[model samples]
Target: MGQLMGFLNIEKKNQKERDPRKRIGDWNEYREAMPEKEVREQAARCMDCGTPYCQIGTVLNKGTSGCPIHNLIPEWNDLVYRGLWREAYDRLAKTNNFPEFTSKACPAPCEGSCTAGFVSDPVSIKSIERSIIDRAFAEGWVVPKPPLRRTDKKIAVIGSGPAGMACADQLNKIGHNVTVFERSDRAGGLLMYGIPSMKIEKDVVDRRVHLLEAEGVVFKTGVDIGKDITEEEIRKDFDAVVLCTGAGKHRDVSIEGRDLEGISPAMEYLTASNRHLLYGEPLKPDFDAKGKRVIVIGGGDTGEDCVATAIRQGCKSVVQFGKHGRLPENRSESNPWPENPHVFSVDYAYEEAEELFGTDPREYYVETKKFTGDASGHVRSLLTGSFKSEAEEEKKWDADLVLIAIGFQGAEDRLFEDFGIEKDPSGRVIQADDRSYQTSSEGVFAAGDARRGATLIVWAIEEGRKAAAAVDLYLDRKLSLLQN
Candidate 1:
């Protein structure tokens, strides 16, 4: 370690977030980078623990407890402390295909499992990671690294989400002629649409996609793989195919008033907002939350995003319902240290709501019974009852617009049916082997949410990297060449 006693001397310093009052006025990332000197000081807090649990990538209590991609966190942290910025970036790039995405979007299970966190605050791993990658970008250290020679092998990656992007990027590195097909107008599927610009600017995703193009990866947007292009056509053109379409079948809140005019799924609302920002497409009058009282169902990451988006769109008021009660402020005996903490902490969106509305928008222990609509068939109010209380606890809240941000079940069935792909009973693509990401059909593979159900972006990247390796081996064996 650069500073043996740095943990005791220096307090945990996190990147400063922009003032909520000012940040919510526009759609931009709210986080401000910490100064380089302070980032080094935070990095110096990494301990010399023999078993660094932060990078162990283990699952505890049915939840991820550390970096699922097995990032070399300690090595990079030490390098940062030594002022070896480039070295830190190199070590980080070796394990993570896209640190820029994870640093912003991930919940940072790695910090929860940090050994130093057992007693005191954890090392600011996410901040250090963001610093390293952002510095590299500013220095022009991140550039196209095309393979030396072409393998003359063709590969098609369906979907341009994180998993598909990671898979396509890796395959391209190994000299395979890779093409990514996206149904949307943009190359990045969820990153470009589902996530608001306030979280990750669209240009950041565009920069990486452009770099991939420079490295000889082909991206075809507005081309539906299973619709405009058939499965037979893809198989005929490419030597292999990897399905990364993601879990798009959103779980619906099929209550009595689901068909009301003012109700829509989270993705539909988010996609509309993204399109409005990127293009000149105006938000639909009904979907627009401006001056409307909004109710978001399901308190998860998607719900938080809805809250943030609604605030930015000038909603009259926003309230999110969490079916489950609030989490504990500290871990209980059942959930010990080194596990992903379920402790309560305010997210960026909730903080913004607190600043703008003078109160948190989350209401726990609330379950929706049905929705009521006005004479025009537009939703007017929501009917709800307490989760654990008596029937007398039923309440009604006025709402002009409602967004169902519950969750996703699996990938859309149209693609699977078009490809004749086999799926598990739970609707996940059935891989031939747990270790091998190959699907039932030859020369076809599955990874990310399509195979594992909806998960974190970090997990999608990890699965994509692993799937690329599997595809590389399959191609090498067929060509009688050593694997890259």
Candidate 2:
């Protein structure tokens, strides 16, 4: 819309990254800032289709298609193309509470469904989005605006992750007194710990949290809600409670030599590394990958994170195993337009590992059969077999450290039981109405990974906003009854 045939003229250019070899030596963000001029040109490539599928956040064929938070992609792109950065930022802020987090961390499902992508490369939406927010912050357009008035009602949010933070932010903006409880020593649960600093620096998360604090949202770190304060006490102290504890129960690979000392869960490894980086804590011997041969089991974002972390820790050698075969170079028949394309591209971790190790670290179509450890009960090597072959052909790889990055099952079970909340059949998540976000226990609501299973941060933020709206309605009804 900004320029006719702009998509054809302007080549798609993404944000540049720091040299992988140099970046792996330090714990810092990899992406370099894009220049404003280039960003505007990228924005001009937006086709501004009649039916913009990029903004239509929905699931198709079990894959997310567009922006889950329903960001106004086209409007912001046009604004950016016209050099109205402040307006673009305002438009972006209307839907996405934290573009900084999502721009850096999200997979950018919106780009996948872009109309330009069907014919040519998609608009550099992610880079443009990042630029808008970064410019806004630099220009001091982002400032704390607390509610004009206060309501008597108080709400408690149980986590400080994206969902919990979004819920608390919205509730506070609506004049409710919101207090967020985080079990960690610092705020930003997974954002602070589960993810490595290279992906999203801790200060980025802290900046937003500090702004929220200035806006009158109370964050109580180092508070374990179920243990330090009882559920009964929470219900009595606050009018409503929203649980945003993410699905953190990690999935395990039960195999031979499972009790070996060097085998650790992916979260534990990532969390330990991050804590050491941020707080200057010493890493546990098993989590430290220095001068050791590392093998990452399972393939996903978490697994890639592990690979990158190991490279940074100076691992002697590294390899990743995946049960599934490699994805096609281009989209296949099953993966059509407007759906997240199931295509393969080199990710940051792969690029970094290859740069350091002189070869790609991934081994596809491989299944771990068992582990063979040393006499000292430390893992020494692992045996793997072909994942799809009729006859299991086994191969052994020496490894001093093994990381299990399979995925998470759901939220922890004990917390829900202690709160007297009903859980679904799997007992992994709180049983809550999909639309209402209210749990079986009245006055208690659940959102994010606790209600739904483990999902994208964008989805979690959306759920948090929705849950806040639902809680607001429920509180209004309660107040009305009391008045009557």
Candidate 3:
């Protein structure tokens, strides 16, 4: 390493972020950029630990720390510090096809496992990562490298979400003619529509989509496989099929006045909000919170997002309900360091809500019982019951816009029957095998949330890449270079 004592010489610097007052008014990304020089200095902080567990990607400290996908963190960090931009990009692309996405949205488990964090702040891994990839795009280094030879085989990927996209990208690189079928008007299932623009910009997703298109991958939008096209046609036309649709069908609140016009699922609301941004118009079955009193019923990231969105829509007031009690401000014994802490997050959304409402809008240890709607069939307020782990029942709230933020059970499986594939009892499409992702029927494969249930985007990407590897092996036993 260039400077063994560099850690002591320079203090870590975080990226510049947007002003809380200004960013809260809209739904765009709030983080600002770090100066190039400052980011390189942060790179100097890596001590080059012997094991470098930050990149090894295994659980540490009892579900607290560790990276996933095992990035070559040190190698890229050194390259970035030396100003070897292209080399840094190459090192990054070795494992991750879309560092830009992870850099923006991922919570950065690698930093949690960082050894430098023991004494003070961890190295600016996420910031540096975003810098390298963004530079790669700017420098025009991210070109489409199509396979040298074409294979006679064809592959059909269901659900154009992250897993499907990753799988399609990898398989196409290995010479297969891959086609992605998305039911939506766009190709990127969640990435294109489900995720709000504030978190991940549309242009970034479009750029990747353009590259995939130029690389000869076919994206067929507005086509539902089980409905518009028959499964038999898909099965007969392609050598294999992969599923990457997300866990989107939400759990409904079965209670009095559920049919109230203003009560809606979190995804339905978020999806409409995103659609409005993309299409420059309103959506059918839209759930706009403008001038309404909003109460979001759930504690996770989804709930936080709703609060932010409500504020943007000019909701009069907003509150987020956490079914369980609040988490500790810092890591606890059960959720120790390096295992990814279950602590409070002052995310941009929360920051915005606090600035506008004059207080943090989160309400812990609460649950909703039902809604009371106006005579016009619109939500007026919520009747709620509170219980944390069945220990006690207390607390309630009055709400006008009742948003159910409970999690999803599985994929939109309306199309599952057409493929003749088996599904688990929970409605997750059954993969052909654990080691091999093929379905019960020959030439059909599954991956990502459609197969494994709803999960992180990183995990979806991993599932897509691994399934592609398996499918590539299945097609040509000759063994292409990088089978996972």
Candidate 4:
């Protein structure tokens, strides 16, 4: 709206990434910030459509169609275009609790659903978002503003990932005393350990954690619920409990030689790599990919991350196996727009692997038959077959290291069982009321991956906010009854 027909006139452009060859040498973020003027120009491309699908925040055909947190995309874009950066940040903060996290890690379904993208490229919404938040931080507009009033309610948030962090932030902002319990030494669950540093640096996560601490959120790291503390203690100390423990049970490949010494889960490998980079911990021999021929099983973001991490670790060779065929260059008829266009686009990891290996390391339509290990009980190679071949033609590739990155099944059942929470038939997520996020027990609720299985960070944040609201309402009702 600021610039008429801006979408047509201003061609879409994205923030530049550090060269794959150069970026692979360091664990820092690969993206370079776009100039302020160019970012504003990109914001101007937003059409401010009557029906902005980018903010709909709905699911279509099992894929997210827009921003799961329902960010005020057009309003902020117009504000940025008009040089009202502070206002833009304000609007962004209204929905997203952690723009810093999502802007960098989220897949950006909002851009896929942008109205301007119908004809031309989508507005560089993700880049604009990152710019706005980064500028906000630099300008000192972001600070800890603790609630002015205090409530008698005290809530315990289990897990320190995006959902748990968002839930705790919202509850603390509403005058509740919130204590976040993390099982790891660091507070950030997925953001700290699960994701590699090349994508999101640890300092960024620490900055937000420090701000939350300043806002009076107590974080208890290295404390495991149902182990270090009992369920009775949590119930007695806290007025309410919200479960945000993510679905992190990694699915495994039960193929031959699975128990080989060099085979590990992708999350385990990534976590070890992050710990090694952050705390100077030595990587275990099995987890270290140096001088090894690595093969990542399964094709997803996790697999791509494995490929990148292996490249950084000086792997001799790397290949990723995907059961599905390669995606089409463009969206197929079945995969329409606004449904998270499942077309082919090289990700940062793939780009880095291609740059280093002289070709993309992905092999699609490949099914692993078995792993062959050396006499020392370490994986030596893997046998794979093509899905397209009628005879199931087999091929073997040398693989000194194998990372299983298939994906997570869901939340660990034992955690929910410890709290007396019910799980659905799949036994993956906590069974809770859909609207209230409340579990079978009173004064207890569940949100994020604990309730919905593995999902995007945006959805986890949204669930956290909504679950916080429900918890607030529940606490207020209890208080009213007590006063009576």
- TM-score against truth, every candidate: 0.97, 0.99, 0.93, 0.98
Put down candidate 2 lDDT per residue, 76-147, tens digits, no spaces. 999999999999999999999999999999999999999999999989999999999999999999999999
lDDT of each: 0.91, 0.92, 0.80, 0.91
Candidate 3: 10-residue stretch with minimal lDDT = 58-67
Give the TM-score comparing model 2 with the true structure, all chains together.
Answer: 0.99
RMSD of each: 1.8, 1.0, 3.1, 1.1
lDDT, model 1, position 374: 87
Question: Which lDDT tens digits does candidate 3 get at residues 142-227?
Answer: 99888899988899998888889999999999889999998888877777776777778888898898899999999999998877
| Regions more than 4 Å wrong, model 1 | 390-392, 480-484
- Residue ranges of candidate 3 with Cα displaced over 4 Å: 2-10, 58-65, 283-286, 389-396, 431-434, 477-484
Query: For candidate 4, lDDT tens digit of each residue in 1-484?
Result: 7589999999899989999888999999999999999999999999899999999999999999999889999999999999999999999999999999999999999999998888889999999999999999999999999999988789999999999999999999999999999989998898999998888999999999999999999999999999999988999999999999998888998888888889999999999999999889999988999999999999999999999999999999999999899999988999988788999989998898888888999999998889888789988988889887859679999989999999887788776887888887554454576678999888889998888888899999999999999999999889889999
Against the true structure, candidate 3 reaches a TM-score of 0.93
The lDDT, on a scale of 0 to 1, for candidate 4 is 0.91
Backbone clashes in model 1, listed as residue pairs? none
lDDT of 3 at 310: 83
Q: Residue 452: error of model 3 in Å?
A: 2.1
